[model samples]
Target: MASPASQDIKSIGIWIRVSTEDQVRGESPEHHEQRARAYAELKGWHVAEVYRLDAVSGKSVMAHPIAKRMLTDIRTGAITGLVFSKLARLARNTKELLEFAEVFRACNADMISLAESIDTSTPAGRLFFTMIAAMAQWEREEIADRVKASIPIRAKLGKPIGGAAPYGYRWRDKKLEVDTEAAPVRVLAYELFAEHQRKKTVARILNERGYRTRNGASFSDGAVGRMIEDPTAKGLYRANYTTVGESGAGWQLKPEDEWIWTPVEPIVSEELWERCNGLLAARATGRRPAKKTSYLFAGFAVCECGAKMYVPARRGKYVCAACLNKIPVDDLETLYRSELADFLLSPEEMSAHHAAANEMLREKELLIDAAESELKKIVGSENELFDLYHAGALNKVDFGRRHKPLSERRAQIEDELPRLEAERDVLKIGMLSRDEVLEDAKDLSDKWPDLPWEHRRQIVETITDRIVIGKEGVEIILLQVPFGNDDELATKPLGPRFRGDERY
Candidate 1:
C-alpha cells in the first residue's frame, strides 16, 4: 500500500539487520544505517531510533529481538511509521507480513519499504504491497538457486568454501597459496605431531616461535589438530561429511571417496602430511603420554643487563646472572605494565613531530637530487678518462692511476647514494603522529618483559643505542647519524625522546 501523501510523518524508526553468516560480505551494519538515515531524511521523516541486529537469521522474524521490538512499537503507537531497506528485510514469510500489517493498522502507523516503494495508506498502494511481497519471495528463491548452482561448480573445481583457510596456506584471489613465512611453522607442527604424537607440545613449539593465526591470535590444541588433519596441505580436498549437533550418539563422520583433487601450492610433502595424521590418531587412541612444563616464559624472556635471566633453584623469582639484578617475577611484570603507560607520547606532541619530520623529508629530497647531479658529472669525467686510455693518448701507468682514483670515487658516490636514499625514505615517513607513536610506545613498553630477548634488544636498539643506568636514573643515548656535511642535517637526533613523565 502506498502511504497517503497528506499523512504527516512526524517520527520514524529504522531497523538494520546483518546476518553473522554473511559477516564476510562487504556491506557492514554501519553502511546499512547510513543508507536508512539518508532515505528517512529524503522523505522528511524525523528518525526517532535505529535498531541494529547482527548475526541474526532473517528467515524467521519471531526469532529476532529487534523484530519483536519493532512490532511492539507499532502496537503501542510509539512510532508514526516504520521504514526498512526492503520488504524481505522486514519479514521473509508472507504470514508474518500479514501479522505486522494488522499491528500497523491498529497502531495507526504505516509500513514503508524504501526499495520496494510500497506504502499501506492507499488502495493502489495496498495492491502494490502484495506484488512487492511476492517479488521479495521470488528474489530470495533466485538467490538460493544461484548459491546452489555455484556450490557444485566450486566443489567440482576443488575450491574451498565457507570455512577458514587451512594452516600454512592463505586464501587469496579466490585460490589457496602457500604462506611463505608460515611454511616453516607448518613443518614444525608436522615434526612435533610425527615425533612426539602430541598436540599441546606442538602448540607450545608454535607459541615459542611467535607463530600466530591470521588475526595474530594464539591457536588451541584442537585448532592445531585440525591443521594436521586438513587434506589441503597434501594438495587434496575431501568431501567428507561430519554431522553437527549436541548428542555424540547421533553424529558420525562419513567418508566420501569421490574427493576433489585441486592443484594447490603445497606447504608440506604428501608423505609428511600422512605421517603426522597417523601419529595424531595414535595419540588420540592413547598411544602417547603428555609432556609437562613449569616455566611460562621458559624460552621467551631475557634480561637486558647483559645477563641470562634464569629461574633460580628455589622458585618464584627470576634473576639476572651477570648484573646480579635479582628482580622478582612479579616486579618484572609490574614494571612492564607500568612503563607502557608512562613512556608513550601524547597525541598533540606526536602530531607536531610528524609535521616537522615531513618538512625535513622535503628538504632531504632536494639535497639528494643535487647530490645525484654532482655524482653524474663525476661519472662523465671518468668516462672521458677511459676514452683517452683506450685511444692510446695516455700511458698505461697514468691511465691505471687515473682510472683507479675515478673508480674509487664512483664507488664512493654509489655507496653514498644508497645512504641518501635511505635517509630520504626515513624522512619521508616523517615524525610519528602522537597517536601512532603512543600506540607503538605502549606496545613496546607493555610487552617488554613478555617479549623474547632478541626482540627486546631490537626495540632497545631502535630507540636508544646505549642505556647507562646511574644511581639517580638512566641515561639513554640514541644513535644519531650525520646526513651529510650540512651542519643542520648532522646535528639532529634520529628520534625524539619521551622522558618518563613528559607528554608524548
Candidate 2:
C-alpha cells in the first residue's frame, strides 16, 4: 500500500557501492542500482541522484571523495533518503556505519536497506540500527585483537609479519637469505671502514669504484656507518626492536628485553663487524659533547621581544640572548602551577553543564515517545476506516479522504523519531565527555608536584601554548579547556622576578 505520508519524501539518492570482487561474482553496480531504484519507486520517492562508489573498498569509505560529497548532500537536504542493497554494501567498517546513521538521522533523512529490511524512518528500524551497529563494531574489534596478539608469536618464530626485507637481504620461500649482489657490497663497507678508520673515506671509495646503494644512489657517510653497525651482517638479525611513536615522533627503539634475535647466514665474521663499529663509536664519543640537562619549559618560554629563551649550563634560568631578558626557572614553574589551579572548572559549573545537557536529552526522548504513540493511533484509525468501507457504510471516495491524512501523519512521525533520537545521542556524548575532561584536569592539578620531569614536560606542551616573560612579570597563556572557548587565557603574576634581572 502506498501511504500518502510517503509524499513527504520528495527525493532519494541511490547508493551503489560494489567492490571489484562482488562485481566479478556477478553483483554488478547496475544490478544494485536497479534494485535500489525499485525500492525508491515502491516508497513513492523520486530518484533525484545516484552516488556510485564503484570498485571502492568498503573497509574505510569516509575519507573517499565520493563519500564526502554524499555526506554534504545529506547535510544540505539535497536528498531526503538514501537507498542501498544492504548495510555491508554501504560500509564494512563498523564505526563508519554508525557515523552514516547519525548523519542521516540528524538531517531528518532516512536510510533504506533492502536486504536487511532496515528503514530508519520507522521506530522499530531505529532500534535495530543501534543494535546492529554495536554488534558489527564488536565483531571487528575481536578480529583486530586476535591479529595484534599473533604478531609477537610470529616474531619469536622468525616469521615475516609483513614488511619489506631489510637491505642486503631478501625473503625466499618465506625464509630470510642474503641477496647475491648487495651482500658483497655490504660486507665490503664494513671491511673498508675498518681499514681506513674513516666513515667518509669508505663512502668515497665505494662511489669512486662505481658502487651504488640498493636504490642506485651514490653511497653516503651516514649510510656507511649504519651498514657497518647493523647486526644482520654478522648473522644475528633483530626483530620487534622498534615501534612507531605518537604524533610523528618517528620510530623509537623498544626495550632490550623485548627484542628478539634470530641467527642468520653471516656475510662477515662477528669480530670484524664489532671492530668496525668500535671505531665509529669512538669517533662519535670524541667529537660530540655530553647533552645538557633539558628544562621543563625550554621550548615553551619566550622573551617579551619575541625571542626563544635558553638556559645556560648551571645558570638555572631562561636567558634570551637577543634582548638579554632572563627569568629564574623555579619562579616560572611556580607561576605555571598557580595558573593551572585557576584554570580548573568549579564543581558548580560542572553541575550546571551536566543538568542542562540531561534536560535537553530528556526533551528529545519525550518527543520521540510521543510521536511513536501517535503513529500507533494513526494505524488503528486506518484499520477502522477499512472496516467501515467493507461494511458498505462509506463510499470509496469517503474512505480515501479519511485514510489519506492519517497515512500522511503516520509517515511523518516515523521520520521524526530517528531525528530526535540522533540528536539525543549527540548530546549524551558531549555531556559525558565534559565530565571526564574536567576530572582529568582536576587530577593533573592536584598531582603537579608529584609528576615526573618527562610527564610534566608533556603536560606543559599539551596545555600551555606559550609563556611570555615581560619586564613587569611573567604571563602564562594556556590552551582552551573543554568547558571554555577562549584559548589564550593569560594569568596575573605569581611572584617577583629574580635578582640581577636585565631589562631590554
Top-scoring candidate (lDDT): 2
Tell me the lDDT of candidate 2. Answer: 0.67
Candidate 2: stretches off by over 4 Å:
1-169, 176-344, 383-393, 443-504
- The TM-scores of all predictions, comma-separated, are 0.34, 0.32
Local accuracy of candidate 1 as per-residue lDDT tens digits, 22-104: 56764456655665665454334567667777777777665466776665544333455776667777767765665466445
lDDT of 1: 0.54
- Model 2 per-residue lDDT at 503: 27
TM-score of 2: 0.32
Per-candidate local distance difference test:
0.54, 0.67
In candidate 2, what residue range of length 10 has the lowest lDDT sum? Answer: 486-495
